[model samples]
Target: MYMSTILKIAVRNLTRYTRRTLLTATLISIGVIFVIVFGGLASSFKNSMINVITGSLLADIQIHKKGYVESIDNLPLNIFLSSEETAEATKIISGNPNVVASSPRIKFSAMLSNYAQTSGVRLVAIYPDKEIKTCPDLAQRIKGRKDLSSIVNPGEILVPELLFKGLSLKLGDEIVVVATNRDGAVNGVTLRVAGYSEGVMGPSGKDGYIHIEDATSLLRMEIPEISEIAIKLKEFKYLSSSYKKLADTINGDTFEVHTWEHLTPFSTIVKIVDVLILMVRVILTSIVLVSIMNIMMMSVYERIGEIGMIAALGTLPRQILSIFFLEGILLGLISTVVGAIVAVVILTILTITKLEFKFGSMNIALTPGIPWSEMLITVTIVMVISAIATLQPAIKASKLEPVDALGHV
Candidate 1:
C-alpha cells in the first residue's frame, strides 16, 4: 500500500473514534504544556540567581594560592600569593583575551572598633578601580555612595550594613581596625567609613571592604601581598573554555583556578534545580507512555472485525501495521504542535507580566522562554514514545485470523 493511502486510512479510523482520540490527545498536550512551562520558569530562576551572585561579588571566576580555600574560614595570611606569583598570574590574566577584568584582594580577619563597641569582621582589601570593573554591580550594593567612580579610597572602608547598624556607626565615622601580621606582630589602622554595604546573604554576612593601601599599612608588610584574584569574563557562556585555558597555563601545585560555582554553596541549589527539572521530564514521559498505549490498545480491540475484513480483502499485514502506526504518529504530531503553541503563548504572557521576587537581599525578575533546541527535544520524545506505545497493538491487529475475528460479535 502507498504511504498516502495508509495515512488516509489512519485518519479515517481516528475520526471513527473521535471522542477517544481527542481525549488521549488532550492528555498528551497537557503533559507537554506542563513540562515546557515548568522548565522555562526553573531555568529563568536559575539564571537570575546566578547573575545576582556573579554580578554583585563573586565574578565569573577566582584564582587563589593552593590550600587557601581549605583554610578560608581562618583567612590565613601566610598562604597569600608571593610577589613573583602575583606578577606571573597578572601577566597571564592580562594576556588572556577572554578576561574582561580582574581584581586582586587581600582578605583577612580583624577586630573593628567604633570607639565604644568592637566586632570581629572579615575584610577584603582591593583596588577601587579594579574591583568596580570586576564586579559591575558592587557599586550598587554600597549605600549613600554617589561617587561610584571610587568605590573605596585609601584610609576609607565600606562596612557591612549589619556591622554599621550594630555598632551604630555612620558614614564618614572613624573606626579602628586591628589585626595580627603573619609574624605575630600586632598592628592597627584608623579608617573612615565610606559607605554601608548591603549583605548578599541577608544580615548574617560580616564581610567589609577597604583599600589595598590601608591593608598593607595595617598588616605592616614591606611589600604588597595578594590573597586571591577575582576575574570577570567577556561572556559567561565562554566560562568553560576560559577556565580550561587558564588552568592549563596557570593552575599548578602552588596555584588554583575555580569558577564561581566551585567557590559558593549556591552550586548545590543549582544542582537540585536541575534534578527537579529532570524529574518533571520523567513525569511527562510517563504520562505520554500510558495515555498513548492505552488508547492504541482500545482502538485495536474495537476494530478487530474491520482488521479481519481488510486482511480477507488481501490487505498485507505490513500495510495494516503501517496504518495503525501512522495513526499514533499523527496524533503525537498534532498534539505536540498544539501544546507547543499554547506553551509559547503562556510563557510570553508571564514575561509581559514582569513577575518579580526576592532571593535573599537580591530582587529578581522572571523572563521565561523555551529555546528551539528544548522544543525540538520535547517534540522528538513525544513522537518516539507515541510510535513505541502503538507497536504492540499494531502487531496484534495485523496478526488477527480472518475467521476468528469474523465470528466475534
Candidate 2:
C-alpha cells in the first residue's frame, strides 16, 4: 500500500511539472542522437576503408625481400634467389589453410612507348590465374564488357584507360617496355597491347600491367627477386593471428612479413580516432548526468513542505524518498524510448538518401550508414545516468526528519 501511494505521488508531481521535465529530457535526447549517428557512420566508413585497401590493393599480408625497399622504385637489376627458393616459398604459402591464395609479384619502374607517344608506368608481372584469384575485380573487368579480358597468351598487356587516353594508343598497338635486366643490362621488349583499362593505380598515371612471362623475358631473368608477395586470408577477424603465424612459419632472418596495416599506416591512426570518439561520448554523458542531478534537486526543494505533511501523517521517510526516486527513473525510461524512436526515424531517412562525399581530387568511400548496436548503447547510457543522478536527492528526502521538515513550513 505504501509503495502504491509513493508511485502515485511521483506520477502526480511529474504531470504537474511537465515543462521542466520535458526540457531535461530534451538535453538527454540530443546526446543519445549524437551517439547513434556517429557510431553508425564510423562503422560504415571503417568497413569501406578496409575493403578498398585489402580487397583490391594490398591483400591482407605482403612478404618482401631484405633491402628491397631501399631500391625498389629504381631497382638495380639483379636476381636475388634461385627459382627453387621461389618455388619453395610459394608451396609453403599454398599449403597453409589460413592463406586463401598467394601471388608472386615483380614491380619495376619502366617507360612504355609507342612510336608517337611515351608514358611512365609501374610494370607488375603476375601469373594470370593467381592474379585473378588475388584481385577478382581485375578478372571481372577482363572477362567481358571491355573486350580486354580475351587474351590468354603471354606478351599481352593491359593498360588503364587513363594511360590509353594519354598515350593515344589503341588496342593491338605495339609498345616498347624498357627496364634494367637482372644482369644490370638495360633490356627492352616490344609487345602488343593486349588490353586497355583504368584500374592501374587510382587517377593519374600511365600505369599498366603485364603477364609474368613477359616480365621474365623483358628482365632477362627467370624470377626478378619479388619485391612484394600478396597473401589473402580466410577472414578479416583472424588477421592478427594470421600475421603472427605467417611470421613464425616464414621466419627468414633477411625478410619481414607485414600485415596490410603495416603496408598502410593510416589504419592504426583510424583506430585511434575510434577510441577518441568513445571518450567524447563518455564526457558528454557525464554532462547529461549533471543536468539531471540539478533538475532532481530542484524537484526535491519544491516538494519539501508537502513531504513534511506526508511524514507527519505517519508516512515513513523511506516512502518519501521512493516517490522522488521513482519519478526520476520514469523520466529516464520515457526519455530513452522517445530518443530511440527519433534516432531510428532520422537514420532511416538519411540511409535511404545514400549520402555521398568526394574529397578533393579523390573519391571518398561512401558512408556505411547507421547500426542498431550504437543506438542501444546510447540509450543504455542515458538511462544509467538518469538512475545515478537521482540517488543523492532520493537519499536526502528519505533521511529528512518530519519535525525539521514541518518546522520550516
Candidate 3:
C-alpha cells in the first residue's frame, strides 16, 4: 500500500474512537498546563523577592572592605574602610557613568531597653536623604512621626511596627541602647522612638535605625568609618561591567564588590524554588509518559484482529508500527497546542487580577510572566515522551503473527 494510504488508514482508525483519542490528548495537555503555570509562578516569586530585598536597603551593588562579609555577624567595625578610604572608594564608584546613587551604612548589634524591658537588636545607622531615594516603599510606609530625615537629635530612633507591637513601646517613648564600641569599650546612648519605618525583610521588624553620627558616637572611633557602601546603577543589567570598572579603579586589596544576591541570605529561597520547579517537571513527565503508553497499548490490543487482517492483506508490519507511532504524535501535537493556549489565557487573567500574598515579610504578587523558552520546552517534553511511550505497544503490534492475531477474540 502507498504511504498516503497508510496515513489515511491511521487517521480513520484514530477517528473511530474519538473519545479515547480526546482523553489521551487531554492528559498530555494537562501536563503542559502544570509545567507552564508552576514555571510562571516561581519566576514571578523570585522577581518579587529580589525587588523587596533591593528596595529595603540593598542597592544593585555593594562595596565592602576586605573580610567584612565573613565577620559581618560579629559587627566587625575593625575591617571597615575609614573616612579617608571611603572618600577614595566613593570617587571611583561615582566616576562610572552608569552609577546613579550611593549610600554608606554602619551596621552594629546593640541592646535596647524601654527602661521597663530590654531586648537585643540589629541596628543600622544610615543617611536618611540617600536612603529615601531608592527605598521609596519604606518612605511611603513611615508612620508615627512627621519627619524621619533628621536623626541629628541624639535621642530619636525609627522602629518598624512589627517590633513596635512586640516591644509594647509607643510613639514618643524612650529606649536606651548599649553596645561595645569598635575599641571594645561598652558605651550607651538614649533614643526616643521618633517614627515608625517598615521593611520587607523578616528581621527588619525588630531592627532599629539611627543617625550615622549617633552610630559614630555609639560605636566610638577616633576616625570616621563605614561598614559598607551601597551603590545603585542606571540599570541592573549593567551590574557586572559596572562592578568591574569600579573594582579596577579602586585598590582591590582594600575593597570587594558584591551584588545584592551575594550580600543577603534570601538567595537560598530562590534556589529552593528552582529545585521545586525541576522536580515538578520530572514528576509530571512521568505521569504523562505512563498515560500515553497505556492509551496506546489499549489501542493496539483492541485492534489485534484488525492488525492481523491488515498484515494478511500484505500491509507491511513496519507500516502497522508506523500507524501507532503517528497516532501518538498526532495526539501530542493536538494536546500541546491546545494546552499552551489554555495556559496562556489563564495566566493572562491571573496577571490582570493581580493575585497577591505575603510570604514571610515580603508582599508578593503572582505576576503572570511565562517564559517563551519554558513554553517551548514544555511542548517538546510532552511530544518526546509521548513518542517514546508508544514504542513498546507499537513493537508488540509489529511482532504479532497473522494467524494468532486473526484468532484473537
Q: Output the number of the TM-score-best candidate.
A: 1
Candidate 2 structure quality by residue, lDDT tens digits, 1-409: 6787777888788779889988978877776776676666676666665665576556888777655655655643442434655666676678778888777777777778887877778877777677656655554334222543432347777775677778887778888988876556787888777776445234564446787788878877755566577888888787888888767877476566788776665588568758866975796588668877898899988777777788889877777778888988887777777877777777777777766664322234545355767777777787788889988998888777777777663
**C-alpha lDDT score of every prediction, in listed order:** 0.88, 0.71, 0.80
lDDT string, candidate 3, 284-345, tens digits: 68977888798889989999999899889987888889988887777777888998998888
Please report how far candidate 1 places residue 26 from its true position, in Å. 1.8
TM-score of each: 0.96, 0.79, 0.81
The candidate with the higher lDDT, 1 or 3, is 1
RMSD of 2: 4.2
lDDT of 1 by residue, 1-409 (tens): 3898899988898888899889988988988888888888888888888888898889998899998888888999999998889999999998899999999999999999998999999999999899988988888788867788899999999998899999999888999999999999999999999998887767778889999999999998778889999999999998999999998999589799999998899989889988998898888788888888898899888888889898889988988898888988888888899999998898889988977987888878988865556678788889899889889888888888887777664
Which residue pairs overlap in candidate 3's backbone?
155-192
Model 1 clash number: 0
lDDT of 2: 0.71
- Report the candidate with higher lDDT, 1 versus 2: 1
What lDDT is reached at residue 397 by model 2?
A: 80
Supply every candidate's count of residue pairs whose N, Cα or C atoms clash at under 3 angstroms. Answer: 0, 6, 1
Residue 70, model 2: Cα distance from true site in angstroms: 7.4
